[model samples]
Target: MRYKLIPFLLLTGSLHAQQTSVLFIGNSYTYANDLPNTLRQLALSLGDTVTVASSTPGGYQFVQHANYAPTLTAIASQPWDHVVLQEQSQLGALPFPVTTTQASAAQLVDTIRAHEACSMPVFYMTWGRQNGDDLNCPDFPFMCTYQGMQDALIANYTALAEENDAFVAPVGAAWSQVRALHPLIELYSGDGSHPSPAGTYLAACVFYCTLFEESCVNATFNGFIDAATAAILRGIASEVVLDDLTAWNLDVDDVDASYTSSTNNGWNAITYTHGGAGTHLWTSSDGQSYTTPDATFVFSAGGSYTISHTYTDPCGNSDTETWVREIVVGVEELEHGMWYRVYSGVPGQLEVRGLRGGEVLTLFDAQGRSVLQKQLSRSAERVVCLPGMYFWRVNDERGNFTSGSVVVR
Candidate 1:
């Protein structure tokens, strides 16, 4: 049976506490050095949490995962955000099994979609055996040399990803890159087939970039590896993965910065709300800024205000927009003089009456941050906000404005 995960595909909520779940299906290479645990640690260091788990028999392949009851049961255990498939280290580098790997991976992909509709199956392209698999070198010509085996693995995995129209977390590519640039890093263990602590960390970094879409450059967890080596591995993963997101067939965009605002004569401030992807940054020229959502802007000499905001996705894409707001500041709307008042109805409650039609009402706390905003309905609408002492403002469609303070405690 498949368990449904709310916020299945996209990581739900901008809050860091909400975790995305990932499953690694492979052999000892994935379980070696506790790779899934390393991935989770790295994610946490970056202020992102990923609930991770893995199933790996000593030398399991895609066919094994597809056929084995335990592995299939693990896949159905929860609606994972990304289900990673790693074929036995040497299979994809071979001829017929290369095609077999593709078919098996596709079958698992279909199964994943059948169960968790939003889950994405990622081909965990593993690297070549250290110095080539001497045990299999006699049977496979490419296994005779390291570079040759790596080349074949790359070709096979890329082909599989293209054929299945799936995502590939190029961990193998990242490994090859590190080997070329930092030959002394020692990614392999004494046995040559399994990964060293550094190797698993590098794999974890690649997955971090692939799944989380964020730079792992500053991640604090270095595993049992040294800081310098960790930094180099992180750099390699970023250069290979983050730089060419499209290569992995990902469609990423800047964070959403949708908002609403009101500019009226009496309020003496701009009642604004940041409802879109909650806010990476909210500000404009002249040094006005608000770091959080729902903020108020008080004009110096009310005329017009140019507002702009920017938001960035975890993938590093950013979007920004600017608009102009006209503020009459009661120049004509309140020329005859007007007055309004706020009253506390009950503990942690307040009420307002005589509001102009289509007016935007906002409440701001002592710190000048906008706490509440609503499009009022002429009569009255209870504006709910945190219990506190706050100043309120109202701006009607006709440019009429009113302002005062109220307390709810």
Candidate 2:
């Protein structure tokens, strides 16, 4: 199974723009620099469309938002593609806060599902304070350092997302990376708690990749920062989200490009019967293409042909599978002067020739169910009632059998 990746490719005239709608429900961490608008601008720069709405108060928590009328109203307003939930920066990191954080998250998730079953719940993982949680650091000594607090936040946020079958933006993970690499960038404001403009910019970049599942490295929206700094932030966001999607659960829930194929006459029918979600495209080495998930194509001659199927989810994540199939045209010989060939000379019938006398011939459908069986006193042709791929076998009096496949059109 070889995979070829076409990542972040520029849209051609044939490609339609991908559109998404998201609703952010968090506090100042989300609204400080208008993160939703920032995300919208970044998506525009990337040749995609993102519609965003938010309900963020100054200092709102999941428990508060779960019962808050305005928040509930937002969830029910429209069928959002995703609804992001961010807990208070400190609450998720606190020791034994699962009751408050997990319970409220469950309630909000249930409400979101009731409104729109397909809407995904995203947990906004925030960074730890620049200095530390001085108020709670004394009692919970682990919060005395920035690293400890960030670690705790990651664990808690991951638990919440996993529990609710949701996704995590990993903004805090990206924040930690940028801080370690460029400490002078100033991700936090003077208060050491709220985000600086750069902080929010980085957060927006994370969301851009998370919600869109596209690369943010070259996005044009810098958002109140120099291009160099913005580029750094975007790179961090891309690595944290795009590279390790499983960590944030940004990867598609399920995707399988595997397909079943059968050749009839010269036309090969390919079908993707696996369960998954994505937009599918089928392409052949013979300069043929099909947008439908299942399609059939005819070959000019019998030979090995490369057939490939690629499926891209709504979030831009994609998987591809390629197969090399051999097609035969003439009769195939099994043993000394004993040859058998399955050919379609007339419509809806298979003519078996080159068969030795006194041999039993059996025909089976694609499901391996026996449709017809008879001892051939002489070579014969049978009329197939259905148009599909069928397997056939020939058995001699000695009980040895030879099997092959044929297609009816």
Candidate 3:
């Protein structure tokens, strides 16, 4: 049988080039047990220069940060290459209760823009503690489940980053990946709020890897711990890719069963029912196979079906795979130019821009009405008559709108 192979992109050699100075603004998640220091050490070992300037109170949220915007603005004004920010874990998870988190995130973005040098990048930091652990100390229901809170936090960070044209460092997902691996990593300390040394090291590893786009090896703790603990720490410090299975098959009469991938790779699986009783299952990887408990299931003739699978890597990386199959039916060809191109001025921002280019460039409103038209030229940037929301077609000779959004302010 022919199998489809998914290529893996490794970061083996890309990180060895340049050194960078980064500023970390977070609470204990960023400074607990000198994680910033560990990050500095890791960078030094890799022959990179890394200095961590941090302002982390014990437990602070974006709202609190906004209250001290002047201080944050001052810190951000410095000539740092990258700035990292982490919100209180609970605030990220339960943003509804604290509605100011979103506003605070926006305010922070504005402050960063005002203070940062041109083109400086901002990275949102993601975090996770142990299951059922409440670091916020209020003991609220929203802070109860690790998985639910983590999902909420990730969603908030993703939205905030997209709105402000920023990047994210998914450390919380990385923690989940490690948890899936051993189920006993215990990212928290005895109280289950603060990170243990191992947990801190893991966070540092993520920061180092993402910031430098490199791998972290030989992260040994100082003499503060014993040898056995150190060995356990080393074991957990290592990174690995987990297998992601996209599809599975079972008899029509059986209830659903859950299967984990060997590593945390992403994949999709689909099953087709045939002849009233037969079920055929296929996964994203051609080599992966699925079978029913009994050989009684098959795909139904002319039936269409699809399934998608997603997984997080050891460092909290995520991807999705889709499985599609039709029983004895020819696939439909996707027609070129059937769909119009869509563009946003700034993601999550109030303004969006759209354009279509050929011999001339045309801009359209959200309603697809042409609002402005411009002539194309080799050296001139495409100028829009009005701002707000517009969509651009890609057929023009000058390349279509740039990949990312534009901010008027």
Candidate number with greatest TM-score: 2
Candidate achieving higher lDDT, 2 or 3:
2
User: What overall lDDT, based on C-alpha atoms, would model 1 receive against the true structure?
Assistant: 0.74
Instruction: List ranges where model 2 is wrong by over 4 Å.
Output: 1-17, 95-98, 259-320, 327-409
Candidate 1 lDDT by residue in tens digits, 1-409? 0112233232432343335788888989999899999999998777677888888898887887888888888889987877888889888788755357767888888887788766777788889888888877888887888888898887887777777666778888999999998999999999887899999999999988888666789888899999999999999998898897777754322245645333232435544554444346767555688867555676777567778877654333467778886666455446214333355555666666665557787889899888788887757556556677787787767675666566664
Cα-based lDDT at residue 51, candidate 1? 86
Q: What's the CA error at residue 204 for candidate 2, in Å?
A: 0.9
Q: Is candidate 1 or candidate 2 better by TM-score?
A: 2
Alpha-carbon lDDT, every model = 0.74, 0.77, 0.50
Ranking according to TM-score, highest score first: 2, 1, 3
The sequence of per-residue lDDT tens digits that candidate 3 reaches over residues 1-409 is: 0011224332443323345667777787777788778878765655555766776787887778766765475465675656677887667766555467777777766766666533233444455556654555365565567776677766777666666656566566666766777566566778766777767766666666556444455444432445554345434333421111011000111222222111100111122211112232434323344443111113334455454344332222234446553444443322232223222233332222223323354555667787666554443243534445444432345332221112221
Worst 10 residues of 1 by lDDT: 1-10
Residue-level error in angstroms, candidate 2, position 330: 10
- Least well predicted 10-residue stretch by lDDT in candidate 3: 244-253
- Candidates sorted on lDDT, descending: 2, 1, 3
Q: Can you give the TM-score per candidate against the true fold?
A: 0.58, 0.66, 0.51
Kindly provide the TM-score of model 1 when superposed on the true structure, using C-alpha atoms: 0.58
Task: Give the alpha carbon lDDT tens digit for every residue of 1-409 in model 2.
Answer: 0011323456543243466888999999888878899888887776677888999998888999999999999999988888999998889788644348888889999999988777889999999998889988988888888999999999988878888888888999999998899999999988999999899999999988887676788688788999999999998899889887888876535455765323232223322322235587878888888777555666667789898888876544567889886666563423433545555556777777766678887889878899988777666656555777777777777665566666665
